[model samples]
Target: MLYQDALLERLESGLRKSLPQWGLPQDAKVSLLEISENATYLAEDGNGEKTIFRVHRPDYHTEEEIRSELAWVAALREDGVVETPRTIPTEDGSPLSSFSDGEATRYIAAFSFMSGKEPDAEDDLVKWYGELGEINARLHTHAREWQKPEGFTRKTWNFDTIIGDGALWGEWSAAPGLTEEGHAILEKTAALLRKQTDAFGAGEDRFGLIHCDMRPANLLVDGDRLGVIDFDDCGFSWYAYDFAAAVSFLEHEPYLPDLMAAWVEGYRKQAPLSDEIAAALPMFVMLRRMQLTAWIASHGETETAKSMGVPYTEGSVALGETYLAENG
Candidate 1:
């Protein structure tokens, strides 16, 4: 409820006192530029230096887990697989910092900013499918080093758990955009979930530290190369789920399968995906779509979110209907 600014003041003061390991002067002029529920940013300094200040929700991730994540990112950079913001350390060189909030909450640390161009949003946009694959290959290959944190459950990212939380399915299924085809999608997926409950949770799905939310928005394409950012959602998940998420939001972009294949081939080169994971992708894709729409429907308040989402929400519902009809 303090909004992003109040959180930033506390985060900046901490950064000023901490994070010399990031190679910044103690008194470096820092400015807050980007702030989200899980991240805060300091604008470009006169020397063009910038760093992302972050605070992961403690309800979901622990402080120690966050520290391990940064350490892993630093290690990945050393491996030359992918690019991540360099983690800056506190004066004592610890990566974790805290503002001493209630036991359930804590303010975390910061990292140097990585770079990328904004993805083209226009209709002519060529979704960088193959490049996305290569990037994911590097990400998965690099993520294998970090030990998973405790109580960090693995998410299979299928049709059930994503929107099958019971609380959501009823309303989500009844949302305004349910095309007749969409109804079939829900019905068929429900049946599949019931038939394959145990199969959905397979451990052979190549679980490791996944980028978790590999959306187009979080990736930067410099020339033919791709750089990733925004690790707020990084965690233990099925590798294909990460790949599914990368291509999920890009349905509006051109050439989706091409992009997906590029990422899949690259990831497979590092660690081959099981047939079960490959077969489960469509359901997971639909599940992710439903879950994201439901997230916006429930939490979206800003004009931009609601306004931009109105069309997306409707489009997704429509897509659901179409998938349902085709599968029927």
Candidate 2:
């Protein structure tokens, strides 16, 4: 059974062998920075050079699924449209490596670290999310050319599971200050989405490889360039959902038509959106909000998460309150 330290040592060994091949120095002493549920480490050479090493979770996928993930990124790189972490093979040139905690661990892969700065909402809000929108555009563009990987299947994004079925609202109604109105909103919103989700199946609206999670945290900005990471959630899905995600998460400035215009402008430079996409953006915003709202509502005071109540449900209610008071 490989322990965490032993697994890391194995990862370091892989990096020591691979980075130099990418033209990194032999004197590189890689400094490991962050490790997510999917393990990644940052290694720095003597010249302060850094690259990311990835350890894929075999529990989450098959070797084919792993191949599909990198292939999607590689396809985009080939098109000269985006920056994907260069996959560094093992000593034998295999794109992925398998190891065990003996407790059933997963497949892991290593990559050359990408460079960039993390954007923040507290500082320059609009610009920060706008940058995220640009990266989303780039990711989905060349991604359209990539072949679907062998072991991969469609991902639900769980939108319907999270908010529909009345069972969903039933599951979260006991939390403090949760009202009948919020529950009703969840039921109604989910119903509306379900009836329309497949309304544009795999057409221009549904086609393309989507970076399912386009949250601001996954992006890196260097000067005017941006890099995106965390593609474990990548899959074939609605192209507009990508826009919906970028628009919602990065809507730092007031949610207005002008800011939406800026995002559309930047996204078009990579892959343009259609009129269908434009019309659905507002509903997508509503859907993402409610999904997060319901998730938080179910797990109030989760030690690691920020809030416990539904976000959009309460938010819209408060906005309504404000509107009514001013008018009445």
Candidate 3:
């Protein structure tokens, strides 16, 4: 625990140092917003002007990869494709900035504060999900047509990077509280996912750059605007994977079928959905579930991971069985 505490101290110090790069005053009231893969902070000056600061966890994405992400965000905003927080550039006019954490250099970026709450389950989730679907479809449409900048690079969420040896979040087999029985079930499920996804070939129309983490938690719903956030996971993946990501961590909800149908309806409003792609939605959902299971294991230090704990592992096992029975 001492090491973790020390790490936190360093991060706190780094965040203070980073504010000056964005011209934030030393007296800026900074409060933590969340701690997942990155540490997000809400900083307000004496005048009540607020900015959202994102302190990136090192080694996750290279400086170049981050620039690539910001590039896309700029394009998305400039093209009016979606409503999202605008990037607040540094004093030097760079979209990204960095500070020393004593141990390593951590990157940070500021954004114009977006106002909205995450859509709650009790709310009209089915309706919001329809809007979410339309937003994703529009993003996909832009991704397909936009000309990417030279040397642009972002990781791909393919079979290899998702659950295979190259799994980005970590191996599902290493998940906490995984029982031997559960492991066996997931192994079979993974094998099936591999077989089916291998056949789902990545054609230009079916696969391209996408916002890989479009879950409800990443959304901000005001009266009429659905603002998306946390594009940190945006990259190349199957178009259907975005739908799978849309339902992250809520895989077992009874209203899932209704949500999926709503999403498909909303997506069709913007672009065509082939019968083949439509049929493969469940497979992508299973893949995302397994990926998140691994994420909870590897990111156990985060509150979100701790809250999920063993129940999520067990839930994945049940979902795996259902997926296999239906898809087998």
Candidate 4:
């Protein structure tokens, strides 16, 4: 834990240095909020006003890609397609700033503090998931109709980028505690996914820009508003992939069927759902499971990854076996 502690201290220092760029008090009380793919902090000024500052992990996204993400967030808010946190510009009116943490230069962006807490399992999950489905449908519709700015670019989450040789998170084959039996099962599952997704094809309606990480942790519930946050992973992918992402890390839960049904019902209210795409939802979920397995292996330093550990790999194997039996 020494390494993580040291890293946090460095990042905290960087955040303090960055606050001035956004015209915030240098002595603002800043606390770490989360440390996933990025280090997020909550900064409170002397007047009690708050802002969220996100320090990007090095090498994950270029400056251009970060700007593209903010651009989309701006459009989504401006067009009333979704309720997202507004970006706070720097003193010079730039949406992003940078700080050197000695090892590498990290980009930092500030956002208006959004009010709400993440929805928990004890809540009315069915209702919340239904709302999530509708929200995703609206995002998909916007992705389809909106005109992207020139030079807009983001990563693509196809089979190759998700799990194959080009896997972004890392290869699932390297997952902790993955036995030979489990590896074989995942191999078959991957083959089946390739065949099915290839046959399904990437038509515009089926595939487009997506919020690739819409799990509940990124959702905030305040009264009737369901605010979505964390666009760090947004990119090009199958539209149905959003549902798969929504159920991340809970693929084995019993209520999943009910949740999936609610999501489909809610999504249908906003857009058409082809039988082919609907049938492929399970495939996408399995694919997401595998992708997350890879993520756990590569990001073991984070608490979330460490907590999941070998159990998550074993669960992926079990899920893969069931997927192969049902779909292979």
Choose the strongest candidate by lDDT: 4
Residue-by-residue lDDT tens digits, candidate 1, 1-328:
2334565566566656544545567677766554433545574455876767675544555665666667667777777877666777766777767664445455567777766675655422244655566667667766665454554443334344456755321245644455676556655655554455446674634666677776767777676656777776666666666766776555554466555556566656665666767666665666666656665555443232455465776667566666566555
TM value for model 1: 0.75
Best-first order by lDDT: 4, 3, 1, 2
TM-score of each candidate structure, all chains considered together: 0.75, 0.70, 0.97, 0.97
Clashes of each: 10, 7, 0, 0
Q: Pick the winner on TM-score between candidates 1 and 4.
A: 4
- Rank the models by TM-score, top first: 3, 4, 1, 2
* Higher-TM-score candidate of 2 and 4: 4
Q: 13-85, model 2: which lDDT tens digit per residue?
A: 6556555554566457666665433556676766776666666643556677677777766666667666657
After aligning candidate 4 to the native by TM-score, how far in Å is the CA of 292 from where it should be? Answer: 0.3
Go through the candidates in order and give each one's C-alpha lDDT. 0.60, 0.58, 0.89, 0.90
Candidate 3 structure, TM-score to reference: 0.97
lDDT of 3: 0.89
Span of ten consecutive residues with least summed lDDT in model 1: 167-176
